[model samples]
Target: MKKYLVLLVVPMLFALGCKEKKTETQPDQIMVTEKPKLPETVLDSLKNHPPEGMVWIPGGEFMQGAVPQDKQAMDHEKPQHPVKVDGFFMDITEVTNAEFAKFVKETGYVTVAERAIDWEEMKKQLPEGTQKPADSILQPGSLRFKKTKSSVPNLYDFSQWWEWSIGTNWKHPQGPDSNLDGKENFPVVHVCYEDALAYCQWANRRLPTEAEWEYAARGKQKNTIYFWGDDRSKLAQEANTWEGEFPVYNTKVDGFEGTAPVKSYPSNGFGLYDMAGNVWEFTQDWYNVDYYKELAAKNTIAMNPQGASQAYNPQNPYLQEKIIKGGSFLCSDSYCSSFRVSARMGTSPDSSAEHVGFRTVADPEMIME
Candidate 1:
């Protein structure tokens, strides 16, 4: 079987509102119940605008996940259902190389891709008696995508173009030979979930919950396909996505072959940029193909659903994966049609790629502080 890894890695390396009602009974009785004072946190949220580089997403109900009519919708995205999320602040764009560098500088943090592999941990997910790869192969590195010479029918054989390159990390996204010298504004790729979480902690923000992410990406629009609208034509002008055949060819019609600079394209209705294509973003949710089914079965709006309590991918049950939202520049109509607002994907928490990155979200309470 051509593992999903190939199709997955080949890409590059690879809000709420409230209303009040009047009571009918006590016109003459003059009954007055103090409207619950907006909590200080809520008041602070309303009084103060979102922090620099963040946008406030008003809370509300929306249909989250692939619509029934979307031909590109996958099994995991099925049974589109309603989800309610509270208002929160989200980064205006993906964390950039410069921003991540600053975090590393301030905290002396090393990304998972830059750290040596743990053989003990690796063996846990493998069958018994499986021998460890050579120490050279276990060195710190990440997956990087290389273009194929010609189009191939099978996009899943990611090994064809993805190399487990040594010295490839967020700072050197392409490989050991590459550097971010002039690409500080580009989204920082090759960051694992733990790396992203560490940055979030230093920044005092957190990953957006899957529901919060979908709700914000919808941008208060009702059941739209792409973040801008249902029109695919807008993608060429509004988002950075593959313009021609993916993997083998890219026309760069969108003015970018890989990741584009932050805010290179227009912002969505919520004033958030690159929510469609650019790079896939990490979400505070575990991967579970049937998670949506479980939520849909509730037959009621899921309020701030935190996602599956644990990671589960039936196809790769031993590997724990987390949900990744948005799509990357490698996303094209021909393959990985994940730029759709409701499209979803997942990968192991420890995995990193040239086409994956993340942004942060802050709760009202955090923002208040």
Candidate 2:
């Protein structure tokens, strides 16, 4: 449930064939395409998800984040405060290929990754007269994670977890060698922020807000060290995480070394599964560092709190990353203990990875009405 904070976007220069610098189009590019409207019957199909993957957490009060002056806590997680939310339902499981395929088939919709790059849009990123059709879905370009040697000083190399691979998309992960074949049960990966948003639209739902997501993930707790309370030893048995060494060797101690199928473990009090370990879920918020400070300063629990300005999924620079919660099977105690409910990470709206996935939540206003 933790979110990565430093996933903000950075400016870069790209010249197609020209020598001058050019700025890329904004991340939220407007692209028009035809899509099938959902019929009432089709829209009703999602009414029933397996109970094992989801649970209802009645809305109320809970202390959010670690207590100040606690022996173990981060600055961002400080100033533990009370948060109140209305009732809502969340998927018991991370969205799977089967579910996403159902949405695609019913809507005749293609994902952002599935769409060919707009040459016109790409042109805007290039110096004048330097634009050309460089790549397409006909060809491929995706954010891929690659392990590399220490390019920076040996002590400051966080480059071990990511690489920008061209063909490593949702359909063909790990480059050409990968296929969706038998992995349909695995949570869909390589999706950008817009891709997850599109899926929610098709499903008649929306991404949870960071507060809502944390409230649900925590089930019901007040300043507990974790979703299950403060005990890392207990975590070893309940969830999937990296074991053995740091990055290179995964012992699969939790019986899973990579992405595991949804509902691979017991559900939380709210009956939601995979909220702690699996692929991280996206939240509908813009991230900001002083966001909490701003919230507290306004004498408000949250003043329309969103995420930051720009966050990049290490795999892709074209998209701006947002907040993604709940670490994956790849997270480790030594590297990323983000499996806790308050843990966090950031990702680009247009970038996808083998370890990123999401679920849907109903609009509370509509439900209440």
Candidate 3:
């Protein structure tokens, strides 16, 4: 979904949303296997009880990055390497609207989408010689999926599905007209990386590092495609994603057309919900397309690997991005099949979109401090 949450520092401000960078890679059907159960943990006798609504994930070493058999794997996901992480507590599900509202109520924090766009600051992330747009286009807004009437020219143009809508934010997911009326239980969307970090600061929690996110997503199932193992057959019934033609119609086979409520599906081996699909969860890693290769070259297990030191996206070198794990409702086999555990994307630290959200984690040491 790297492109699904794509943040193009477009000279055209009217357009928001991302288009997957076209790839020759094809996804062949993978082998089927049973979803694993959570391994026994020492939580029962531990003094560090998981923070409320959080689960303690006892860390262990595992082969990180994509396996060769993952036909859907991208260049960035390749060159499997070794990694280990410290055990920590993670949010059982993506941060829900209700939970985020509590943060907003207490901190009175306004998300990036709610703020007026600044041309002076925005141009810094754009290409030189790019003309500044009109005042109306610089108003508060966020990206929302706008379904096409029928198949478009091709999927390469992400603008076909993602639309930059004014008055869109966490409170108003779709646009100014939409509200969180009955959707408080749904995972909060239209939250950018900066917005997520703000919430983390307020809550005294932090976003999981890229290594931790992938490790927890695996749920003890190593060398497998998803947290539920490599059973691609059961993916539709297990994760909330587009069941029909993407950017056009959704069959709603997953019981919801858009974002489904948390716990709507079975949890992963670590008792984590929506680890596969829902909304893209932000991680602490800076975006580096070759970070995996760099780690693999070490020939030694990366202990608590904190992402790349600097942000780099050859596609969009102007804007800085952070790693985003888990695919969103827009994900599909025909499109960006990023629901797999290893699937990762990068989006602007300041951009917000409908299909993007985040969760939080806490290091055990932080709790003691």
How well is each residue in 125-207 modelled by candidate 2, as lDDT tens digits? 33354424324322334555443333223312443455445566777766767787887887887777788888887766778
Q: After TM-score superposition, what is the CA distance of residue 325 in candidate 1 from its true location, in Å?
A: 0.6
- Over 153-243, each residue of candidate 3 has an lDDT whose tens digit, in order, gives 6886777778777798899887898899999899999888888989999888999988889999988888898888788889877899888
Q: Ranking under TM-score, best-scoring first?
A: 3, 1, 2
| Every model: Cα RMSD to truth | 10.5, 8.3, 7.6
Pairs in clash, predicted candidate 3: none
Q: Which scores greater on TM-score, model 1 or model 2?
A: 1
Runs in model 3 deviating more than 4 A are 1-48
For residue 213, model 3's alpha carbon misses the true position, in angstroms, by 0.4
What are the models' TM-scores?
A: 0.88, 0.74, 0.88
lDDT of each candidate versus the true structure: 0.79, 0.60, 0.79
lDDT of 1 by residue, 244-275 (tens): 87688899999999899999988888889999
lDDT of candidate 1 at residue 222, scale 0 to 100: 74
lDDT of 3 at 189: 93
